[model samples]
Target: MNGYDSALFENRTVVVTGAGRGIGAAVVVAFLGCGAKVVAHAGRDLSHTEGDLLSRVPQGARSRLTLLTEDLSQPEGGADLARQILDRTDRVDVLVNNAGTMGGRIAAGTETREDYDHILDLNIRSVVALTGALLPALKAVDGASIVNTVSISGRSGGSAGSALYSGAKAFVSAWTKTLAKELAPDGIRVNAVSPGTIMTDFHRRYSSKEKLDATAAAIPLKRLGTADDCAPAYLFLAANALSGYMTGQILEVNGGQLMP
Candidate 1:
């Protein structure tokens, strides 16, 4: 919705990883509203998140959403996801690399090598592996797009124990630009969206209410962003009509939290 071209993705098959909740759910619903068949991925068994997502989808568009399950943290996860996509459709119009997690904030003294590997594997390695595996399917479709979900923490160093997550996203942001240039010749445009202070389970789980309110107060917009506010940015990047000429770009969806 968001008043953009609702049918911009008509008949297209868009694959969105991490669609079980938050930004991923918002993006899936947006694509469905716009008339695209969406392949939504979740890390675990279908749960309340999927149920909640279904309720938000229009009845007629309900059938457009197909669920795919895979733990992107595992070494074989990306290939597993891509195999399912290829099984469903030969051509993939869009691929949203949104499957990532901000791990438990480990204090400096308590951190271990496993912590670093977990975040890097989920946030950066999975993206690279999935995209590489699906390259053939993406090539089958003209004007295909790869939209990555990066965080504002990636642009500026993260606060407190968020260094690993921030560093991983920074890799993704940099890789997005590199992929955009490398894939441009094949008509595949790669881009990223940097979201800030979005009110979602991400915050509910990791940030206390007082901390969130403090973040809201510091934002120039005087409020935290909602999933709806950031969803349109992903839609714009995925639809050719909106951002065909734009590539290797990172669109910040923050409410003036950071200038970059």
Candidate 2:
């Protein structure tokens, strides 16, 4: 479980959004374990962090973690969060844009303008604002990396009632590549981790038990994924030692669900 070098990220600064639970929490813990000072955005409040992130992080590592809460669904939410981060640190060595949600299942014809706005605002706009605001901080360091969280649905189009969610993730998948190329000269590597059927609060809210079971049965591993299952991939893509030459790639962590 602890295969990574203990000091892989020593003295580095990593910013992880949506880090209060599930995959984001796992990624934060992994980076801290590797000796990185992590600035974690714990969603809209600290409640989720109390329930998930706080419990998983070790007491010693907690000193290195700076927890913040922000509602990234608002228009200026990402920029506001960036302001808070820049006020604390002058340079960011790694940026993990993991904040986003489906908002909810909206049926095709029943969707409203508000529904589209919520999905796109949180999934797309916030990411853009945050990444844009942090570009200077990232550029201050050498070999800075940005690891985005995408979805398998971006490639498969997802199940019923998830069209908007699927499309938003697809946008991120494409943006990851675009930013990788655009920022290559600045020494910033951009990549994404697309997960599938992770048994997180996300699925508990949107997916049914029967659907999850069926998804597990069809996968080559014959099991659904866990937050821990996907954490290492983010670590790999962020560390220059591991992925210095790798950028603009979407690392799929779906248990062989989608090979494309």
**Leading candidate by lDDT:** 2
The runs of at least 3 residues in candidate 1 whose Cα sits more than 4 Å from the true structure, single-residue gaps closed, are: none
TM-score of each: 0.96, 0.98
- Top candidate on TM-score is 2
Kindly give the stretch of ten consecutive residues in candidate 2 with the minimal lDDT sum.
1-10
Q: Write the per-residue lDDT of candidate 2 for residues 108-187, one digit (tens) a residue.
A: 89989889888988999999999999999999898899999999999999999999989999999999999999999999
Badly placed stretches (over 4 Å) of model 2 are none
**Taking the candidates one at a time, how many backbone clashes does each contain?**
1, 0
Please report how far candidate 2 places residue 21 from its true position, in Å.
0.5
**How accurate locally, in lDDT, is each candidate?**
0.87, 0.93
In order, what is each prediction's RMSD in angstroms? 1.3, 1.0
